[model samples]
Every structure is written in C-alpha cells, then in structure tokens.
Target: METNLADLPVRIFHVLSRELGRDNLWVKIVDFDQDPIFSMKQLEIDNFLKRDNCCDQVLRRWGNRGQTVGDLLRRLQLLSRTYENEFDSIQLQLRRKFKILRWVPDSEEQVTMAVDEETIKLECKAQGFPCPTIKWYTNDSKEPVHTGRSYTVLRCKCSTEHQYKCVATNEIPEGFSFSEHYKRPGKLWNSVLESDFVDITSLVRDDELCESCKNFEMGRLSQILADDEKVENKTIPVPSNLDSTLRAADKVALIMSNCSYVHLPELMTPHCDAQTLADALQKMNYKTVTLADLTLDEMRYFIREYKKLIGDGVYAVFYFVGHGFEVNGQCYLLGVDAPADAHQPQHSLSMDWLLSIFRDKQPALNLFLLDVCRKFIPYDAIGAFVEYSEQFKKFHRAHRNMVYGYSTSGGVGAYEVKGEINGVFMKYLKNHVSMEISVMSMLHGVLKDIENDPKQIH
Candidate 1:
C-alpha cells in the first residue's frame, strides 16, 4: 500500500498530466491510499512516444484501491471535461486501453467460540470495498443457518459435533465485457468466497453440572421437545392473493435505461434489460413507459411528464438502469452529459427529489427498483440546478406504501454477467414481476432465485 506519487513511473505520470491537464491544479503526487489531492504541475514537453501497453500498470494500481475501472474512468472523464477541442479523440484513446474491473470478497478463515451453554458463537473475518456479506451454514444444508459476521446457535448436550461453513460476497460492477485472459479461475476473489469448515464441539458433559442446574437444563430441554412435537402438526401458510383493491388498471411503470454515453463509460445491456422488464409488466396489464439513453434535461422532462400519470391509490413503479453513484449518502442517477468533475446536481436526477415529487401523489405503492452501483464518489463542488425538498428525507418514515429495491448494497457496484443478454438484477426480476401475488412476495422470490446462483451473487 506504499506509494510515492512523485516517484511514479514516467509513463503513468504522463497519462495523468496529459489527461488531467498539465496546469489544472488537480494533479499531484502523494499517498494514493488516502484521497488524492489535486495540485498543479508542469512537465517538459519531451519528444516522448507512447508505448502500446503503457497504461497497463496504471490500470492495475488504480484497481487495487477497491474501485472498478469504470469508476476511475468516469472520474478522469469528468476532470478532463474542459478540454473540449480534442475531448472525444482523447477520451476514446483512454477508453480503448481500459477494461472493466469487478470486485470480489477476500475473506479470511472463520473464528469460532463457545460463548455459553445456550449459545455457541462463530465469527468470520472478511474484507472488501463495501464489506462482504457473510452467511453461515450447517453441514450439507442448502439453507443458511444464520447470517452476519457473528452467528449464535443453541447448544445441546445431546448434539454431536457439526461442521459450519462461512460465505462472504460483494457485488461486481455491471455492464462491461471481460476477455478470458483477464478472468481469474478457482480463486477465492470470485464474487463468492467461502471459508474452511469450522467444527463445533458438543456442550459440556452432564458430570460438570450441579444437581440443581441439571434439573433446570432438563426442564428446558423437555419444553423444547414439546414445542418440536407441536411444530410437526403446524401447516405452512400459502401466499395470499393480490389485494382486491389493487387492479391491473391501477398500475403504472416508468422504465429508464441509459446505454450510450457522451461523457461517461457507455454501458452495454441497460436498454435491452429495460425493454425486457417493460414487456413482462405489460403482460400483467400495467401501463408501461420505457425510454433509453436520455441526457440530463431529457430525463428531468420525462420524469415530470411521468409524474402526471400517477393517480390516487395507484401502484407506481420506477425502474432505472445505468451509471449511478452516491455522494454525501444521497444517490443520483447520472445523465449522458453529466460532467466528470463538476456541476453534478445540474446534470443528474436526485432520488430524494423524485421521492418528494411522488409522495404527494398518494399512490398506493411507490416502488423504486434501481439497478446501479452505489459507490461513494467524492465530488469537487456543487452548483445547484435541481430543487430538492428536505421533506422527502422523512418521506419513507411517513409513508407505509413505499419500497426501494436496490440491485446491490450501498458502496458496492452491481454486475452484468458476460454472455448474458441482461444484467443479473433484471434477469431474475423478469421471472417474478408478473406473478399475481403481493409486491413483497414477488420480491422475496426474486431474492431467493438470485441467492441460489453463485455467479449471480451481486
């Protein structure tokens, strides 16, 4: 993690200076492990010819910062936005040399502890950009025994030793093709990383217990046995049908997909993915509006138009796919012309703004399904263009009819698997969106399906 920026390779220094500008005051040499500080520098215009693979090392070093290549490229693109004369040509040159980088969970082995007679604790250490998800499972069981970094199980003296498995995973950046040469095989850093099995011993022997304590333990054990006997007689409840008040005619959907880009890295599958979801919803009798590759002004225009379509007691869904980033804990969807380095609010649609606009519509369900990265990207400055209401901060708290379904966790990116026609989120969403069941029920099914596929572990 040690880096001396001033001592950087001559090739990398050239790339930064040339792209970020020799005198922009945004390029500096310092510790990259911390946030980069921008400063001005001047270099002699030597007759240096660029090599074919000069940027490869630059890519590797940046990727190690727990950032995808797409994120790094977007930042560079924004910082160089003022270079309008040769912008397209220079950006294209940079793009040709870059490939998308996906993050995976690098997990350590499990740490187990026998905390108490009634509880056995297991802890697994994992490290990743957004922190990996941990799930603990018993031997040969398809379902997880517990979830989180620490898991506790009820200990019984009659039980035998058992093996527990720990799994850690994080989302990968979406919508980029990877060549076979860049792919890692049989490595733990491949989306889902699992730890070695940790065995748990039986509870303390009966000889170690006093007479009074033994009697108390036996009484509790007998009660548990009685509860198990009753559980066998219990019946599984069926999912209730969709509410009678909710009609297909009362449903509406707005789907936006940004595939092409002028200032940011272009995505490959968002347009097609949006269409697939639109078609699926249409079959279920919901009114659908699907649009693709919109700029900032166009996105705002359409959102305003879509807001007029909502009515009282109606089910409204807003689905977006494309480049998105989080700043100051607030999420924004990037427009095609959103600058890489400045005026972000003017060019991007704020989720809070959207929620504020819709909360007053009194829709029966205001659901948002966002399939984008939630990475925290620091911004240089803000020039307000969009008027966001502070009331939306408590919108979710005041409304019980709102649901936000994210493709990935906060500070992590979503994935678009290579060779697939759609991103992983939309791929599974299509399977359950048309079901005639409650909205929460449908979402649960989609989550279960995604969890079952290791490759789809975003």
Candidate 2:
C-alpha cells in the first residue's frame, strides 16, 4: 500500500529493524525518488540518517518491553547504598505511637499538688523503644507545658494549687482507634484518637456492660497493650485482633522471603522484615506461613501447594522479600540457591508463574506484598532486569480485587534501616497495619505511613 502525496516525486524505503525482530518493519523516505531529470531539490539525507540513528538508540534502550540502563544502575546503587539522593538517618521509627502503659503516674485523677522552687519531677513510665514521651497537662489544657526526657521540670513562682496530669503518648497511627474506643474517626486524617490510660480502679467500678463483655474488652485491651510491649522487644505473639479475625473468618496469608542468596551476602533485614510482617499478619488472624532461605525448587513447590490451604470465603496474601529481577520483561524471584551469575533459568522462580497459581485459586482478594526490587539480572542479551509498573498493573487487572503493594514503586530500590530489624517500608507497615480494618485498608494504612516518611527524598 502507498499514499500519493500530490504528484511529488518521492521514493519510500522499506527499512527493517533487526532489533525489533523480523515480524516488524518500518517505511522510510530514504532519498526520495532522486531523478537526474527536472533538476530535483536535494533531499536532507544527512539529517535523516542522524535522526534514524537516534531512533535506533532509543529502540535499543527501551527494547520491546521498555527497559533502561538506569533501571539496573538504580538496583546496584541501592544494594551498594550509593544513591546520591538517598537520605541517612539513625532514627528508624518515624511518626507512630507506642504502647502507653496505664502507670500510676498516668492517672487522670485530679490532684492538687503544691508548687515551690524545689524542682518537682513527675516521672512517666511507658513501654516504648525510645521510651514514651512525658508531657505535663495543667488544668486540662490541650497544649503541654513541658516535654523533655523522663521528667517535666516545673519551676513554680509561688505557692499555688494546680491540677496537673501527665499524658504519655507515642505516635499512634492515624485512623486507628487504639487510643479511644468511643471517639469517632477524624474527618481530615481519619485517625483514631488515643484512648485514655485505663484506670483499672474506676473502670471495674462503673459496670456499664455485662460482666462478660466488659471482661472481653478489658482482655482485648490488655492484649493490645501486650502487643505494644512485645513489638518493642521484637517478639510479637498472637495478638487480640487475631482472635477477632478468627471469629470473623478472615482470610489466610502465606508470606515468605529468601534473602540468604548463595551468591550474595546474607541480607541483614529481609528475614526480619518477613518475620515482623508475618507476626502482624498473624495478629490479624491470618494463617500465615513465613519462610526464609529456601531453594528455588522449594519455593516453587510451596507456592504450588499454597492454593490448597485457601477457601472461597477468604483472601490470600503472599509476601516476598529478597532479590528480584526480570528476564525479557517477565518478573522472577530469586531463592537462596540463586546464583550470582546466570546459569540456568530454574535457579530463579518466575513471579508470573506464582501469580498464575494465585489466580487459579478460589479467593476474593489475592494480596501480594512484594518487597522485591529489580536487581542486576543476567540475561543472555538483555543486560539488566528491573520491575515495571506495567507488569504489576497488568497483574492487578488479571483478577477482581487482586490487591498488591510494593515496598517501593517500580524501578526503585527499597531503603534499609541500619539499626532497625525491618526494612524501611516494612518498619512502617509493621507499625501501621491493624486487624480492625480490611486487608486492603491495612495495606493502604501502611502505604500512607510510608508516604509520610519525613526523610524521604521524593
């Protein structure tokens, strides 16, 4: 087929791109129909050739699947901790509340304490890693008079009777009603306000509900507080929310990550991340299975059999952490047996293959939390491997309500916290996910926390 551009003497060249494969070709006006007769105008052949070279360079860079050199470089930069734009912080715990203890000092009682020049030190004992911040509230004021270390020092000018209360608060995740069970969700941020420290003396006295219900809530509150303390020590058991999930018939999640690669250095945080996330999942009453340092075949076998554990009434979650790469646009997960160099495709499991298994199962929501990043993949021709937004989006579309979230967006390396046991994203996730919400809501909460990282460089 040809188009006649109004009586002009033009010749079209059938330019075939070898890089684009034999099935695809392009038509170019190489040198027009340069007839010796009629004193034809000279074709801009030099500029045309230069333009073609530029187009070829782009095609080489993007390929058929839109890969780039920067993709691989970003992975290496992250692994080596050499990103110029990346920020460093000794502080890992960003904005999130810790478990506030109902200590005697945290009582909401009205006490008239006499003030003088002798420094009155009110100590607030709370269970948090950095220790709970103690702020003194006088006369029920919203603003605190002091917030420093363990004691809020007050230099009284004269002998005055003052009603002072010590408020102990760590950053509680917004939208979670861990603070107050009765307070409604916030209109702006949707965060649940912190509940007042329980005064066991008064709470047991005012019996509003039947003995059973009150005991349950008190048990649940005790469990929540227990989790708060355990989280600080990095040892979380089946929490209060899990029992509620079991009662509600929540779905099960199978979480696993193999960071101890045979060819790579043992990662300091992936296993910790997997375990912490697993604990959170279990607290949400998910029959979660977390594994570390599995071989390629073992990973495949476990995923293959994972479908049998699911039922139609529940959802499934699969969380992966470790090195990830793509070969020819298909994503793959590396096990501990994965080689540093490309030897055989069997050494790494194709992520698409695992998702295929997930889609085959009967579940309402298939949630996959991928902590994997595109690393230096050794393909025969395609020099690099990296995750793409398109692949995840396509998977998202493959099923109805197949919710998934990554630690970082595609083509970026997830950061690591130096002293913290979990990676950057999981650290926030472990702090934010609540059993009170749906799986998607839990993940959305996690994503919100990650987006709010103060030190994040865009």
Candidate 3:
C-alpha cells in the first residue's frame, strides 16, 4: 500500500535528510522556512526534514521546474500595490529634482560696477524667474542688509580697503543663490599686483636686466610712439614662419575630428557629410575647409595663418567628432592616436586651446559642432567613470556670436549606425545640406527626427 503525500514536499524532505544527514535534522528545521523554495509559513516539521541547504540538492528536488518559486515571488511583488506606490514616489521625486526653469540673463539693462577715486558705483536691474532679491555686504560684517531697489552706491570715506559682496537670491521654494565680489580700488594692486608681476616676470625671464626695468623702458618707448589712431588700430599679420597660408574668403570652416582611428571605417561618411555642408555654404557664397584631412600641427598652423588672411566680416564653421574625457570640469578631446591609458597626458587636447584660437580672431559668426561623446570601453574595465563638464553649456551662454551643437546631451553617448550611408548623424546632415536646408532648420529637423526614431542610439 502506497502512502498519500504531496510530491514537492516529500521529495524535498528526502533530499534534505540525505544532504543534512538524518542526525542533523534540527539544522534543517531551523533554516527550512528561510530556504527560498518554501514559503515562510509553508515549512512544517515534515517538509523541514526533506530539503537540503545545498543549491544542487534543492534544485534537483524541485525537479527541473520551468520557473523557480523565488522568480514567481519577485514577479508577484513587482505587481503588488506597495511596490507600485514606491515606484511612483521615486519617479515623482526624480521629476521634481530635474525640473529646470527657463532663465534669461538681463542683458538689456547692464550691471555696471565701477570703482572711481573713493566710492564704488553699483548698477543692476534684477530680473529672473521668481524675481531675485539683492543684498549688499561689506567684508567686515557677517550680516547683509537689503539695499533698496534702485541702486547701492557705497562710499569709501575712512576705510582705505573694502570688499563688497553682491548676493542675488532666487525666491523659489528652495532658494538658489549667486554672488559677485569686488575689492576697493588700489588696495589689491599694492599688495597683490606688484608682487605677482615681479614673480611672474622673474619666473618667465632670468636675464641680467630685470623684467621691471625692461618693462619701464618699453613703457617709455610706448609713450614716445603713442599716437591715438596708430596705437589703437594697430594690426599684426600672422607669422610667416609656418608653411600654411590662409586664403581670403567670405566664410571659413575649420573641422577637427579626433575619432579618426576608432572610426576609420566611418571616414567616408564624415568626408561626404562635410563636403555636402561645404556645398550648401558655397551656394550661399562662403568658402569652407574640412580640417579632418589635416594633422593637428597643420591645423594649428593654418588657423593662425588664416587670422591674417580674413580680417573682418568673415564667418567661421568648426566641427569636431571624437571621444572626449572630462577632468575637474574641463573637457579634453582625444586625438586619433590618443592612448587609452589614463596616465598619458600628452595624448589629449584641451577644448579651450581650440576655442582660444577662434576667440582671438573674433569671427563674425563662429559656429561649432561637436560630436565627441565619452569613449566606449568593455564593461569589465576597472577604472572609475569621469563626468562631463558644465563648461560646454557655459561656453554657449558666455559668448554672443557663437552657436554650439553636440551629438548628444550631457552624460549620454552619441551612436553611429552600422551599414548606413553615413554615421546616423552625418547621414542626416548630408541629406539636409544636399536639399539646401538652412543651418538652423537642418539642426532642428535632425533633432526632431531623432526624437521619433526608435533606433536612435543616443
């Protein structure tokens, strides 16, 4: 006669007895409820005697089941009301934290802080989302008293040294703060400037004649040669030492791509895309150059040479595509041959170096396109990931005549499609330019189209 018993509990008990040993029954009983195979309340004395602590023993007793009890439990928990509530709360918090307000600088009404003989004149119009409050404080005081709306003019009567702090606070639910600091005239100069100049000159030059003496002589010569018209509008031609020459043109485009080695197969794509863009600009009667074909040294030489060639009323377009790394809130673009090793400083190029070149020249419309996202590496790599900088955004806000476009938003990777006519971005750009689309329209259209496409890797 066969005894009637549930198959799962019976088999589990048998395996448990064998694995734990019949003498060790108390151990099994104590841990039985904790075993994931059995529910907390389901482990009774009989079932406790069956199962083992070992994974193999328990798995065998479960008999090759399609879904484990643990999996079902997880699925059920996910579908439960408590889990759903927690998820909703988390999403709400995320939304609140990331909500950014539209902020426009009050450029129309200038904020002028002028230091005359004694007093300092402060003029500013307060305008921001949820309007800002202005507070003025002196270095001597810890508390800042509110200054009336119109202006705050601080007089320096007895105090030869004073520091003014202007604090602008936002009236949001959680206060946001911004402050500007200014020192009294002639105070810092005597303490900091003279020593700094002397130190810097000493460090820069070790000649027998002191730099101070040389500067005095140069100052005398400058005074003797000074004519208002001649000194104010003096022009220096680009150095002729370099082999490169910048031709005169209505418009110029400087392309710098650092991902040449990693994206070697994708070369034709950028080349065609750049040419198409050039064609569009040419139709509008502007000259262009794709700097990807030139070496880093050559590119630098050509840029310096071009400043002399194109004096004024000239437009410029600069494009960069590559892997970039950010350290201490400054972004560095990787060259084609930049080493993957973190310790090699010589391999990277600073973004500021590139920007400084154009800024020195002061082009009418300096358009920049950066396609460099963080480099991709195997997931198992041990190095810590570095964060990108706010400088990218700050650059856009600080400069008036400049426009910048990035392949992807911050902290996101920009992707290149395989088997497409070009990299996804380049392909779209080429098509738009070939159709004679305006620069602004092309950029807007591309971004919009990317939003709708499911395959967009970015």
Candidate 4:
C-alpha cells in the first residue's frame, strides 16, 4: 500500500505530463500535517525552534529555494517567468483532481495486404491528467509487449491484424484500456489511446508522409481517376452524369431483432416484430433491411456495413427488438449468442455506441427505437436488475435530431403479452405505419396501446 502511494506521483505525472507537453514533470508528495514549515503551527516554529528538534533535510525539500511554503511559492512565482502562462496551467492541472476528457483512437483500423517482411506501428492517444502511462500487451500475457510511453511496432508474421492492447492507467481515478488490432502494412506511426472500451481509429501517419507512402497514394489516386485508361477490375458501370449518380437516397431503416437465446428462454415476439416492421417501412417509402437472430459479431458487422452506407444526408432510423439490460448505468443490446454468466458481455453492443454511428455519419435525423427488456431472463433477483438505458441515452449530447424511443420508460420491465402476434411496440407501429401518419403519431399510438394492456405497465 505504501509502495502504491509512492508510485502515485509518477502515475499522476505520467498522464498529466503528456497532456502538458512536458517531458520532465515529477511528483513530490508532501503531507500538509507533516510539513515542518508553513503548517498551521509553522509560524510559531521559527528557525531557532526547528534546530531544537527537527532535521535540516525535513525542513527544506526544495533545498536552498526557501525557508517556508510562502517562500517556496514566491520562488516558484519568480521562476514562472521562463514558462509564462504554461507553468501556471501545468501547476493547476496537477493541483486539481485527475480527469479524462476525451480518450480516443487516432485512426481507423489498419488492414494490410502485405506479403513480404514489413514493419507497422500502432498507437494509442490519451487526453487526461496526470497523464496516463501507455503500455501494450498481447496474447493474454501479464508481461507487456511494449511499455513506457506510446506506440509499439511489430514485424509482419503474415497478412495478420495483430491484436495489441494499450492500457493507460493512473490507478487513482478511472483508467482506460483499448485494444488496437492493426495489420502489418507498410510503416505507420503512433501508439494506442485510452477508453472504457473505445476502439478508436489509428492516428494520422507521420511516417506515411515519407517518400514511399506519397508515391503509393499518388499512384493509387491516378489509377482511380484514370478516365483514358481501361480499368481491369471494373464492376459497376461508369455513368456519364457522375455528380448526379454517385450519392444514394438518405431515408433508410435498420431493423435488427434477436429472439433465439443460447441458454435463456427464446423470445418469439422479436422475430415477428422485425419482419412486420420491415414491411411497414417499405410501404412508408423507406428502404429497409431486416436482420434477425444475429450472433454478436454478425450484429457488429452489419452495423459497420450500415455505417458505410449512410452519408451526410441520411435520415436514419434504427429499430432494435431484443433482450437487453443495464449494468452499472450502461445499457447493452444482447445478441442471440450473449453469454449467460457474463455481467458485461463483450459481444453485447452498447446503445450509446450505436447512436455514435450516426454522429460519425452526421445524419440529418437519427431516431433509435429500442424494444429491449430482459423480463424473460430467468433471474431470481428481480429487484437487482435495474434499467439505465434511459439515463445512458440522456448522457450523450447528440449534435443532430436524435430521438431514443424505448418500448417503455426506464426501470420498468416490458412484458410479452400471450397470444399477441408481435411485441406491443411493433404491433402498434405496424398498425400506425399503414395509416399514413407521422412517426411521432405512430409512437403515440404505441404508448396508448401499451398503457391499455392489462398485464404490462411502463
């Protein structure tokens, strides 16, 4: 415990110093109670009183700089001339509580199609103080692959996207760790960043600005733009009206539902919900794609594909009907294959992350309709399971027209009515979609239908 306390200064300095752009920052832990000079009783204990009992070394850690805390402070103020405002700012950062503002990955996932031996670097960046120590590890080992500072490099073993975890820890406040899986392409740069589970893209490549990378990019650009040359890998027809034809329609619907649980009671309503909603969306002039009973990775892949399809003009509508629950204020949409034992399954997609997809795409309007509940989950501790998705949704300050519609309000369990063809939300949504009404009116109908049910209450 003492050793841990001793490491605190260095730990704080690690994260804070990097953010301060200072390489030589150090920590000195001074107990206010133990201070020989400038304590509450320090004025009474003069130089004569100090020589009577206390050691000289204990008297002045700053060593010849000053006699008291006030003198030391004045000395620091005098020395502040060299750094100007930066010294005060750095001091303020250290003197305050530890915090992480936005820890993000710098770049998209790196995929290399390299065959011959080549080196690739992956990086993680952190924005917090004291600056967090960035370390890399692989293959589930306790020993790190790389430690001290940011970024790590590895030689290519194959066309491998080697997975390395970069951890940034202050061990005082919240620490962040993220996995960076980058393939061995040509030389890249930087290290990994910090997060709860944020897999940020890699940072912009400084190494790639070299002659070889520039040449490669230019060649690729030439190949893409070459109108006079015959393209060998031509799949799509080149239209004469290039500017008019490139972009597709913005109004789209993503309908995903999971009914088949591996160990839990299978839900029949979600599958029914997805199919009916797809039909309704089609009638409403929305291009809808429905994916049902998907495993964890399959859901992620589909969302990724959906992200690629969305553009700036997209008015995207996402509908998820599935078993979902909150763990420590974070809500997760469980896939068909989510583990029964794991409280926080890696496979379970986060609803906040789902909304971030549209933020990245910068959509015109994004509406999320979640028909999620774990009412059927065979858990005896009914009181223990809490609802936090509503809170989670509120936390993200969306920059666009974003609406999060749940089947019911948070903390209340949604029930599956027996003999009903679909879930309450979907049944009414299907009914209202055919009536040629707005989505707001459709939702109002859903709420009214749910309120009228005998077995359920929101």
Q: For residue 80, what is the lDDT in candidate 4?
A: 41
User: Per-residue lDDT for 201-299 in model 2, tens only?
Assistant: 211211111334324433443343233222224433333544322221235566666655778666668766876876777776666655556777767
Compared with the true structure, what per-residue lDDT tens digits does model 4 show for residues 1-458? 11221133554434433433342221122224755433433353344234432223333333333353334343334444433233444333334333442353333422112222234455455444334466666644578767654443423121122455667663232222111111124312133344332222232211221334334433432332332322234343334664432333446677877777896667867866877877777776666666666778877877765664455655678888887865544456887788775344455787666766545566666778888863333344333333424434554664646766778766556567788878777766677667766667777887888788676634
TM-score quality measure for candidate 2: 0.41
The pairs that clash in candidate 1 are 78-340, 78-341
Best by TM-score: 1
Best by lDDT: 1
lDDT of 2 at 75: 28
lDDT of 3: 0.43
Residue-wise lDDT of candidate 1 within 59-174, one digit each (tens)? 34454555443454445445432332223223332332322222223323345565674467776655432245678877778998688867875453322246787887754323
Tens-digit lDDT string for candidate 3 (142-244)? 7864453334433322222344444554322322111111122422111100000001111221111222332443343233223111212543233456222
Count clashing pairs, candidate 1.
2
**What is the TM-score (0 to 1) of candidate 3?**
0.38
Off by over 4 Å in 2: 1-250, 326-330, 342-344, 375-380, 383-397, 438-441, 452-458
The list of candidate 1 runs beyond 4 A from truth reads 1-249, 379-397, 456-458
How close to the true structure is residue 225 of candidate 4, measured as C-alpha lDDT?
Answer: 34
Q: Rank the candidates by TM-score, best first.
A: 1, 4, 2, 3
